[model samples]
Target: MSDFNSKHEKVAAKLRNEITGTEYEPGDQLPSEKRLCDYFKVSRVTVRHALQTLENERLIYRKQGLGAFVADTTLNSGLVQLTDFSEDMKKAGLKSSSGLISLDKVEPIKEVNEILQLRPDMKLIRIDRIRFANGNPVAFDITWLPPGYGQLLFDEDLTTQTIYDVLEDKYEIPIQGGSYRITAKNADDYIAKHLGIAPESAVLEIDRCSRTTGNKKVYFQKRYYNPSHVSYVLELSRNDNESMSSKDGLPLKEFSPSFAK
Candidate 1:
């Protein structure tokens, strides 16, 4: 058993090297399991184990009928980092643009008001936008901010500039950190229209609350990503002091889908 494990690990290491070293580019199909077994002089089971390892690492994805292909890392973002949409697109070698849907001061729903911690009489500035990457719609975003910070955005060109950029550079309001809640949602008519996907298609939704200096909440945003255009990556270290039971672990709850009217 030990010898078999070692053999599979060796095979996986070699394939990982090739994939990372540019021998196999993104979206390139890998050799079949039989071919890999013949090349590595290993059993089919060993080859399968190696392929599974790569798939777990998100380095490759396998089709039901077709063989495994390298994953496009450009579409992946690290979950641990807090980056602006435009910044992320730029890093992926794509031009970022936004189509403003609406920007107005509105009465907040109970949930939005509670999340933003607004006063009773305070109206929220809401900004709705469709984010694009290389001219392709990738995400639909709705942002809610207190009147103070949000009104300032009214004067800026949201199509080309990110709220993060404006807040940090123009207003000198450094974004300290944020909390995120991620879930899988099915696109409704409104989301489908903005993202150019069929209604009922699966999408990745993230709810984020950002803060500024002195731990003051800045803004709350809901971003829905087209699964075909975006993927999230999270790296974990076993040596970290934060244990899964204490830091990373949260009580599991049933998911309920909500659709737009």
Candidate 2:
């Protein structure tokens, strides 16, 4: 049993190397099972097993009658690691800062009251800013926090710090987890004006409600990202127990931009 697993693993590793190391470019088909079998001196079953492993990793896709082809894994970014904008820029070796747009106490902006479970009279501290990387605008952030938690936004220098950082580090309100949804949206006039794109252009909207260590819901935001500057990605696994309630199954690519060219 061990040897059987080991045989396919060797084949899977070599194929993975080729797929990722520029040997097989995106959309390029792999050699046929018979060809792979002859090359590796392995059986057809072993080659199929190897191919299955790559399919699971999203490195390749198989067509029923055609063959396996490399998946285009470029221009996509992962949301697997939940990090504040500052840490995200640090990872990419770029300087990150915020340009404040507006900050003030306000009547609950759309859905802010429900997301935070606030009372009808409780005002929300709305902080609006354009997030920058190396001084280039990448995303527009509109965040709402209850007064007790949102106070950090005023305490810290947002020009050099992030709300998430201040909340977790200073206020000790580490975001333990969050619920998020991603959807493609046409850049509304408000979003386009801030992002400096044409009205009705394409944008990625990431809406999230985050909770603290005590499972207290306190943070809510509408983050509009320029897809050309940032793309949202999530790595999924069949083995993962987490499943979205579905009428049928799951999906992401609902619509693609129709380029007029």
Query: Against the unseen true structure, what C-alpha lDDT does each candidate score?
Result: 0.80, 0.74
Structural similarity to truth (TM-score) of each candidate? 0.62, 0.59
Model 2 per-residue lDDT at 94: 76
Among these predicted structures, which one has the highest TM-score?
1
In model 2, the runs with Cα more than 4 Å from the true position are 1-79, 238-261
- The TM-score obtained by model 1 is 0.62
Q: Estimate, for each residue in 1-261, the C-alpha lDDT of model 2 and write its tens digit.
A: 245456777999999998999798899999988899999998776677678667756688899888999987762312243557776677667788888888888886546787788886788998889988777788898889999888767756787767765764454444646777788889888888888899999888888788764568878988888887875444433322244344323333322221110
lDDT by residue for model 1 over 1-261, one digit each (tens)? 245557877999999999999798899999999999999999876677678667756688999889999987654312334567876776677888999999999996778878878776678999999998888898999999998899899988999888987876566565656888999999999999999999999999999999875677889999999878887754433423333345444322222222211
Which regions of candidate 1 are displaced past 4 Å? 1-79, 240-261
Q: What are the root-mean-square deviations of the candidates from the true structure over C-alphas?
A: 17.7, 15.0
Q: Choose the strongest candidate by lDDT.
A: 1
Global CA lDDT computed for model 1: 0.80
